[model samples]
Target: MQDITVISMIFTTILALACLFLILSPLFKWDTYIQVSSKGKDINATKEALLTTLNEIEFEFKMDKISHADYKHLKKQYETEVASIMKEEEELMITNIDRELKDEVEKEIEAQMKTYKNKKGEGK
Candidate 1:
């Protein structure tokens, strides 16, 4: 009876430690959560700012306070600015995706290398 209680206590402690390690591992090891959250916030802010600028430009054009040439020039400027922002956002997204893919590929290569080493060791 005492042996059974000791074994159960040891098993429970080991299981608890394993669970704690699993929970804390990601917190110490990676920035995936932070990076993704920051990117999402930045993209949302940029989109909102661009939309506000576009609405203001349209309102001014509708009010007819500016001449046709001025309106055209301003519209072109806004379009260019918005397009530049979009391009930058797209590039950032692509960069993030590429980085993740590269990491995955590297991990796969490392796993393959480990497998090869194990096989070679077994053959020896």
Candidate 2:
């Protein structure tokens, strides 16, 4: 029927656009797609997203949906991205831990100073 043909064409166009968006999304880094999710916008989240995308690409390749060249290119790009994301996360975690330790040490020193002052007063 004419109606069925029209609907099928519309569906095909939508599917093609979705594929294009998926292909271009990594290059452009769609902010909303990656940021506004439940996982959050941290380095870990970004790495997870990249991993998921990489897995999807692998699955698609296995299913014969994508060409070998495209699969190879996308896989390499995603792996590089994931490595950088994890490296940044590791550095950030180290900095946070260092800052927390310094704060705790300062607090302990202040408490010790107060105790020393109290002891002096008692001796006098």
Candidate 3:
């Protein structure tokens, strides 16, 4: 009977410790809960947020909930921000395309050089 109680107590203690560790593990690794965002993704998210704001502003203006002057100012500001984000996205796309093109061109050049060398060797 005493041996059974001791075994039960040890099992309960181990189970409690395991449960506590499982519950607190995420707290120790809080940084992993956050996702790392790239610059292009950030720009796209900002643009989407700005567009939503613009839509809300337009709705408020149409509903006569905002002054004409305020609507114009806000609309202009948000539009400018959206345009800037779009330009940045376009530039990022162009940069990536250029890098890919350069890599492809290099690979093609290497392949052609190899073919030419093989043909010359065969002739000899």
lDDT for model 2 comes to: 0.88
Candidate 2: the clashing residue pairs are: none
TM-score per candidate, chains pooled: 0.59, 0.60, 0.71
- Model 1 bad stretches (over 4 Å): 1-47
Who wins the TM-score comparison?
3
Backbone clash count for every predicted candidate, in the order shown: 0, 0, 0
The residue-level lDDT of candidate 2 at 31 comes to 67
- Expressed as tens digits, the lDDT of each residue in 90-123 for candidate 3 is 9989999999999999999999999999999999
Q: Number of the top candidate by lDDT? A: 3
Return the candidate ranking by lDDT, descending: 3, 2, 1
Query: Order of candidates by TM-score, top first?
Result: 3, 2, 1
RMSD of 3: 4.9
Q: Which stretches of candidate 3 lie over 4 Å from their true place?
A: 1-37
lDDT tens digits by residue: candidate 1, 32-60: 76667687676668777877877887788
Name model 2 segments beyond 4 Å from true. Answer: 1-42
TM-score computed on alpha carbons, candidate 2: 0.60
Winner of 1 and 2 under lDDT: 2
